[model samples]
Structures are given as structure tokens and as C-alpha cells.
Target: MPRWFYQLASPRWSYEIMGKLLPWFAIVTAALLVSGIVWALAFAPSDYQQGNSFRIIYIHVPSAILAQSCYMLMAIAGAIGLIWKMKVADMVAKSSAPIGATMALLALVTGAIWGKPTWGSWWVWDARLTSMLILLFLYLGVIALNSAIESEATAAQATAVLALVGLVNIPIIKYSVEWWNTLHQPATFTLTERPAMPAEMWVPLLVMVIGFYCFFAVSLMLRTRNEILHRERRARWVRELIEKQ
Candidate 1:
């Protein structure tokens, strides 16, 4: 393993690195979200079809994207913890659940809001939507499993296995629109293809997506730092750091 990878396993080192990175992530998140929202709501042209209702995409799309990304990170982190016995990786996986759940919920709610106008109904059993709902449930399940287990290590392992099992849902969610007849529209952005929307609209959406990732980083770091301190309370470095503060 690389030196930095080994260093990351140290709770104190992880905590310190997060502390240094937090402020920067926080600043970028704030700036991007604010600018993106303003540009999206105030400046972007209304959709010819949906009019103002399209503005909700600024939130819904980003939240939905972040929710999926968070799950992948959580699952990968859990796998690392399971394979290497890295406490920091476990902390990251644990910290990720609530944030991912919240984002998924936000996506669902905003999707509903976006749906009412676009689909004539606030809710639908569209494949993409249903799979996204299942993703949210998966996050909740991980959280419940983690809380139910009394032993930290046992809890981490249990949740890791569950997360790994749940990984199957992600691709289903991503490809659902294309795989089935669904009310939900195709993805606005894809790596290999240009967005169908005009530059003015997609640019702000891109900014929001980047901002959402930054916000997730800030949230995860804050939660993981807290988990590190709590899990390492008995360590000499943790105790000394606490004393210094």
C-alpha cells in the first residue's frame, strides 16, 4: 500500500485531513449552490414545454445524482473496511448512510413536485422512480442494520454486506428509463453525448451537480470526523487532541 493510503487508516490523520479540507469544500459548495440556484432560477430561459416548473431540475437532478454517487462510495468504503479492517473506512461507510438517505428523499420529493406538472400526477410507479425509491429503502435498511448491531465491528460488517447486496439496484436505477416504457425522461447529461438542452440551461445544471458533490463531501467529512473522534476516544492521540481543544 502507498504511504498515504496507510496514513488514511489513522483516525487522527483522517480527522486532521478532513478538518483542513472541510473549509475549502464548504466554501466551494456555498458558492456553487448559490450561483447555480441564481443562474438556474433567475437567468435561465424557461423550458418551452414545462415553463417555470423545469427550474426544479436544478435541485432534483443534482440530489438524485448525489444519492446514487453516495451509495457507491458507501458500498466501496464498506468493502474496504471489510477487506482491510480499516476503522476509518468503516467510519466513512457509517457516515454516508444518513446523507445518502436524505438526498434520496429529497430527490423523491422534488421528483414528485416536478412530476405533478409534467406527468399530471405527483407519484408514479415508473421503473426509474420505483428503483430510486428502492435505493432510498436500501439506505434506510443500512442505517437500521447499523443501529441494531451493538458491536461496532459487527455493525460495520453487517451493513457492509447489506450495502454490497444493494449495489445491484444502482445500475437498474440508471438504466431504467431506457430499459422500460416510463413517464420519467431520459438523463439530461451523459458522458458520451451532448445534453439535449441549450447551453444556458445545462450550464447551470452542471454547476448545481458539482456543487451537490461538494456539499456531499462537506457533509461526509463532518460526519466521518465525528465518528472518528467517537470511535477513537480511548486512543492517546484522540485524548490528547481533545485535551488541546
Candidate 2:
């Protein structure tokens, strides 16, 4: 391979490496989520207005963050596969769709729950919320197309195209609330601006965000490893791997 990372284009190499790394990711993901959830649910202070209902932020915020991030991750990996014909990249893109969809669903559901208390409604057709809904549909479309196609290469190509096209929605999703006046509040967290909440509140949100990222990594690694094994099953290395198992 010309580059260190490109060598992992090989499905066999990807599988072995993923197998080795999965346990560590799983452990760390579990630890972070457990600690974060406990701290968020029990120790975090209630909002002055939203009351205990605001505690849903732990799940809602993390899932919302992961939902967007995973889609970008899939789109990037899809781009790599499209440009380089890398089987591992395609596998990563394929494996990431369902996970991303799950996170999106969680975000919507948790958002609705949090919304019911704050907004007096379970659903709203606001800009940010609508764009997030589209994101979920895009994830589902990718997964469905991947499953429907008979040929792996064709499936990858088709899904990659969809991912690339769907990327247009990412910016829209991000800026929807800004572009339109909506019930959804402006971002609570921002890179340049100081957070609106006290450190005690936002700190737990940050922790949950990090923990959710670890959980996503753990989930993606497991799914990617499974995909690699399936795609490489006919290879000599994979045969040897199965024999060892």
C-alpha cells in the first residue's frame, strides 16, 4: 500500500484489526455511557422552567449529535470507496447506515419527549426538526438500497451515490433553524460563543457527547468487522481465520 491507512483497504486486514480493537472500544464505550448517564440523570440540576423534564437532554443531545456525525462519516467513507474502489471503505459505509438510522430515530423520539414538556406538543414541522427527519429518511434509503441490490459492487456504488447526494441535506440540517424562524431554540452549545448554560449543566452534556461518540465507534467497529468477515469469507486469510475459530 502507498499509505499506511490505505493498506486497510483489504478486507482481511480490516477484519483482523477490527477484531483486535473491538473489545477495547466496547469497554470504553460502556464505561463512558454508564458514568455519563448516572451523572446526568442523578446529579445534574433541573432546569428552572423545564424542570426534571430537561434531563432528557442526556439522551436527546447525544443521539442528535451522533445522528448527524454518523451520516457525515458514512458519506466520507462512501466518497473514499467511490474514488478508490476500496472494499473496506464501502464496508464501513454500508455498516454505518443502520447505526446512523438508529441514532436518528432516538434523537427524534427523545426530542419529541423533551418537546412535549417544553413546547406542549410531541411534534412540530419546524425547520431543524424537519431537516433531521429527512436525515433519518436518507439513512433508511441507504440501508434499503444496500439490502436490495444483488451485487455487492452495484450496491456499494448506488449507496455511495445516494450518500454523496444526500450530503446536500447536511448543511441544510445544520442551518435550518438559523435560516428560518422556528420553535426550536438556537444552538445551546457553540464552538466560538460561550455556552448559555452554567458549566454544571453543559459539562454533563459534553461528557455525554463524548460518551456517545465512543459508543458510535464501538458500534461501527463491530458492524464493520462483521461486514469484512462476510465480504472476505472466500479469501485464504479468512478461511484460515475461520479455521482458527
Candidate 3:
């Protein structure tokens, strides 16, 4: 085991590190979110076709991207716990569930809103949309399974298995539009290729995407910190910190 791995295994150390890091994520989240919203919603040019309705992409695309990424994080955390029996990893997996679920819900709602004008329907069982809906259900299922189990260790174990099983859906969600005759358009952004849109449209979107990631980082840290405190409530260091607070 490397030194960093051991450092991560220590709950007290991880908690303290997160405490130091939270403020920085919070600051960046606020700055990026504010700038992204203003730039995308207020200043950016309206779409040549959809007009103001297209601005919803700023919210929808970022939410959709974050929704997928959050699930991956939860699954990875769960895997770490299962492999190493790390209590901190279990707590992280548990803390991540609600956040991921919320992001999924946001994605679905914003996608529906974006659909009304462009696709002419508020909701559709299109491939990409359907897969994304399934992703949301998977998130909810993980949350429900965790809540249903009584023992902490048992719950974490169960959640880890379920998260791993649901890993199949991520790819399906990513490729659905491409593989099927879906009403939803294909991805507007990609890493390997340049964006199809002009900078005016994509630049703000890029900012929003990064801002959403920062926001997710902030939420994950806060929730994981709370989970750490609760799980370690009886530890001497935790008690000392609580008393200091």
C-alpha cells in the first residue's frame, strides 16, 4: 500500500483534509456557477432556430453530464469499500447516493423542458431519454436499498453490489442516441472532437459544465464530511472536534 492509500484509510485524516478542501471547492463553485449562468442565460446569443428556449441546454446538458458522472463516482466508492473494507469508502458511497439521485432528477426535468420546443413533446420514450430515465431509477434504487438495510456494513455491501450491477446502464445512456433512431439529438460536446457550435454558444456551455462539476465536488465533500462525523461520532478525535465546535 502506498502512503496516500494509507492516508485515505484514516477517517480522521480524510475528514480533516476535506475540511480544508471544502472552502476552495465552494469558492470555485460559486464563481463558476454565477459566471456561467450570467453568460449563458443573459449575454449569449439566442439560437438561430429555438430562440430563448435553447438556453435551457445550459442547464440540461450540464445536469445530464453530472448525473452520469455522479453515478460513476458512487459506484467507484462502493467498489473501494467492497475491496478494502474501508469505512470511509463506505460512508462516501452512502453519502453520494442522494446527490447522484438529485442530479439524475435534474437531468430528466431539464431534458423534458428542452424537449417541448425542439422535439415538440415534453416527454418521449426515445432511446437516449429512456436510458437516462433508467439511470435515474438506478440512482433511486441504490438510495432505497441503502435505506432499507438496517446494519451499516450490510447496507454498504448491498449498495456496492447493486451499484456494480447498474454499471451497464452508463454506456447505454451514452450511446443510445447514436445506436438507435432516437428523437433526442446526439452529444453536442466531446473531448476528442471540436464542438459543432460557434464559440458564443459552446463557450458558455463549457463554463456551465465545469461549474456543475465544481458544484458536485462541493456537495460531495460536504455530504461525505457529515457522513464521517456521524460514523465517527464516538471517536476521541471526533468528540474533541465537536467540543471545539
Superposed Cα deviation of residue 67, candidate 1 (Å): 0.4
Q: Model 3: runs farther than 4 Å from truth?
A: none
Clashes of each: 0, 0, 0
> Candidate 2: where is the Cα deviation over 4 Å?
none
Candidate ranking (TM-score, best to worst) = 1, 3, 2
Residue 138 error, candidate 3, Å = 0.9
Q: If both were scored by TM-score, which would come out higher, candidate 2 or candidate 3?
A: 3
Please say which candidate is ahead in lDDT: 1 or 3. Answer: 1
Model 2 residue pairs with clashes: none
TM-scores, in order shown? Answer: 0.99, 0.97, 0.98
After superposition, candidate 1 runs with Cα above 4 Å error: none
- Summarize candidate 2's per-residue lDDT along 1-245 as a digit string, tens digits: 46758877877777777778888878888888888888888888989988899888889888988999999999999999999999999999999999999999999999999889789999999898999999999999999999899999999999999999999998887888889899988877988999999888888898889889988888898888888878877888878878988
Which pairs clash in model 3? none
Tell me the tens digit of each residue's lDDT in model 3 across 41-118: 889999888999999899989989998998898899999999999999898888888888888889899888889889
Candidate 3 versus the native: TM-score?
A: 0.98
| Alpha-carbon local distance difference test for all models | 0.96, 0.89, 0.90
- True lDDT of residue 193, candidate 2: 94
Compare the candidates by lDDT and give the number of the best one: 1
